[model samples]
Target: MTIALEHPVLHSTAIALPARFQASYTTRLVAVGVDKRPSDFWLETAGTPQAGDVVIARVTAINNHKRVETPESRKAILFEGVLVMLAYGHRYAADQFLAHVPEDLGPCHLVAAGGIAGTVTALHDRVDEPTEIEPLGLLTNARGTVNVRDFAAFDNPLKVEAPNKRAQVIAVLGTSMNSGKSTTLACLVNGLAAAGQKVAAGKITGTGAGNDRMIYHDAGAHSVIDFTDFGYPTTFKLNFAEIRALSVNMINVLADSGADTVIVEIADGIYQGETSRLLRDQVFQEAVDHVVFSAVDALGAKAGVQELQAAGLHVAAASGVMTASPLATAEAAAVLEVPVVPTFDLTNPEIVTAVLTDHA
Candidate 1:
């Protein structure tokens, strides 16, 4: 098999690969859905890059994200001039950078460690500039520009039918980024698994990163998947309709996995654009059976609970970073009717069963 490179500077037309030459592209986790065999595709220098379009780029400068997560979920250190296989996608990280897919395959920033390339529009004060990369070109084949959605694990058209034997769906939401949502979700998974319940987990939203998914798997979930499994690098800028479909699809997929219970983590906070929309959507509300709100403080906990309650969601309990503080916990528990279960307590099967079963 032969691979060709199409670049005006390199050649007037496509050039064939040398017989001894081999492609050694470092494929990122975001492109894990696509086949990694370089020989299966070629590089097209012409065309506008769109969201989810796979691209081959070289690191020009290192900054915030010094390493890129690989397809194997391993973090590979990045260096100048290192060719990487990533996807063009938008990013929304309040603690990091807010980025959008570029109009062309021009120089952009590595907005996410999960291997998302985009143009950084805004960033938090504490975060350094995003790592810069020069887009070589979009990956292409006989079908034209390759997209992550082309290899989605569940690509069937959206059919939001109620599962006949669906698992109990528990959703974990937080006040904001790093509000302990993933931790709470993991502890819940551990506790439920410890209680002898078959559990499946999915992260329906958020940037394409493996940290939360890894935590869920380590917590003993029978199966684990995220938005990446459905070919979305991030759900930041997606419309409410798209987000709703993704949410329902993920829930149905996890339920169909044969687990008795499905625990899902909704990335970001209650106030996030997509999160807020999902919270208000009738379909989303019907899909989730219980909600666990995570917050960093008493104020956030109170506000988050109110938001969930207003959305007509059943708040099971409150647990998160605030659980680390006795005063904060008491303050939140006093103002809110829901019990403030500490993170450690959440890992106790008895406590978890009581909280969820009582709510049930």
Candidate 2:
């Protein structure tokens, strides 16, 4: 079967195959090969693709499998691998044909499905291991030069085991939205990971925006996750009791992530009532190993720690404030009698050690 030049086979969104393939393209293709693991292609592709995207490839003739059936009347094609959706669903937005690899890499095929393909940029053997990042990406709806799409939590409920069990769990809480919760989580994750601790980071509560967890991942955490990944548009629907349960459950999941340390984020502030009330819940207050509070002012920071301690909750360390306000950090540390490490001074070993050791 001859292939046309116009039909570019996309190896990835970034890389298209070289030119059109020879006449044997179709004969060498298979919709889903038996030998290649269905899950491999998926795990390799997550975190890179998104939903409503196109993927083109020539079919190998070895297997005549029924394509994921989509009635002609249907608006779009749907691919199925028993574990594909559940496996990579939350990592990246993916909508395309599914296939196994460790097979032949014949000529690429056609547009296949989804919206139009973007320009091909890369095509290398996929990686199965995770990588570290800095300045975790925040999910945002508003437009900008850097941000691409508005991030919203999956519109449903989800449950998974936390990433690690023995890992130290430290959650970063903030006084209000945009108060640097994400930024602080990143720094803490990086510091912990650099200290030889395997860290899995997450944002368990918030408006359910996306960028914050991205920040955690970028910060050097071995694995990063969020409430959005847990399938919630925001934490508003979650009562304090729910968050308490979630915190306990999520901490366990992160612990299972095989990391020596875990960073959890509570969006908004300790005084936000919802956030504060949630953390102080017996389940969370008991399970959490540490708490990093982000404050807008010294008084708020002081009060938040005092209240959490008064309620018998753990206070890990204080980091992140709007400006260069030593007074605020100092006052917070003085009142709480804990280290008040600032983001600007995140690199200090003494402070970091104090945080890692003292918090736990």
Candidate 3:
């Protein structure tokens, strides 16, 4: 069940591998972009591993992430000794593990169910230890090491421009992770589509996962994409310039999809490293026409709106977990100048469209 590859040194020619490989969800978009599977692999014992380098590793233990999301989005249960195809990447999750790609192809953890392999540097108090894996080799082809960047959809450099003339860009920002950003965005997409508006969406940041992309598609988005489409397994330690360029490219690509409106979500919270810089950057502020802020509570909603306003970005409305509680919604509405739109109201075409139109 193991594939044999000749090692350049010591004349070694074999390594144990699973007979059937379980491709991770992060590889889904890459597969589509590359149009073919990797035909070869080699154990790079000496070279440093880079973000997005595809690795085939054997699961050494199961812990927090007991399952790996497959390319098909199925949560496939993992067992010790099973081989998983994942990409090396850095991760920044406030409620989970903080991880980075290893310097060498040694043992690491499956930091994300989305198929990211990295060494955990820190973990949230509530989060269990990450699943462990021993990398077997880097997946490769005729060109060399197979990195997600090799199959990126937006490989070309993009020049930042005004928001597309044909599309109105509405960006959704959150107070923090799990603040209902994706839900708000999906609801907005549904509402817009219900009103007969062609809607396209993208998640320009965050770890590579299929959940948000799937939600967008199910919510009636005519076109959907995320960081994964651009070859990033996660946008954890990316710089402001890199993130800004990504934003421009994502917006441009979504706009070109013929949608009249584009709704993009910025992953993580406003205070996160890249998110904070992006909010303050003139380029990002000018790229989007309006912004919807999502937060978990009234205080967060108020403070988030104020921060967005201070950043020279238009605050269209506020929504998120706080809307689920009538008292919380009332409290937010009492102090905030922006409308506190509930998830239900967000789905109402008239209400959602009015929010956008009023901000427009």
Clash numbers, per candidate: 0, 42, 0
Hey, what RMSD does candidate 1 come out at? Answer: 3.6
Q: How close to the true structure is residue 301 of candidate 2, measured as C-alpha lDDT?
A: 75
TM-score of 3: 0.93
Residues 1-360, candidate 2: write the lDDT tens digits: 222222233345223222322211111111112113222121112123332111233232211122221111122222221100100011111122222111112222121111111212222234221111111111111121111112222222233323333766777786666566778878777776666678898777653233555577777878776654443333543555556656666677677778777778876556655676776566566566777777777777777777777878677766776435867666666766767788755555456667768556
Q: State the weakest 10-residue window (summed lDDT) of model 2.
A: 81-90
Clashing pairs in 1: none
The window of 10 residues in a row where model 1 has the poorest summed lDDT is 17-26
Cα TM-score of candidate 2: 0.53
On lDDT, the candidate that comes out on top is 3
Candidate 3 residue runs with Cα over 4 Å from true position: 1-18, 29-45, 156-158
Q: Which sequence of candidate numbers ranks them by TM-score, best first?
A: 3, 1, 2
Predicted candidate 3 versus true structure: per-residue lDDT over 143-229, tens digit per residue: 767798887777636466555467889999999999999999999999999999999999999998888999999999999989888
Give the local distance difference test score of model 3.
0.85
lDDT of all predictions: 0.81, 0.47, 0.85
Tell me the spans in candidate 1 whose CA falls farther than 4 Å from its real position.
1-37
lDDT of 2: 0.47
Root-mean-square deviation per candidate: 3.6, 16.4, 2.9
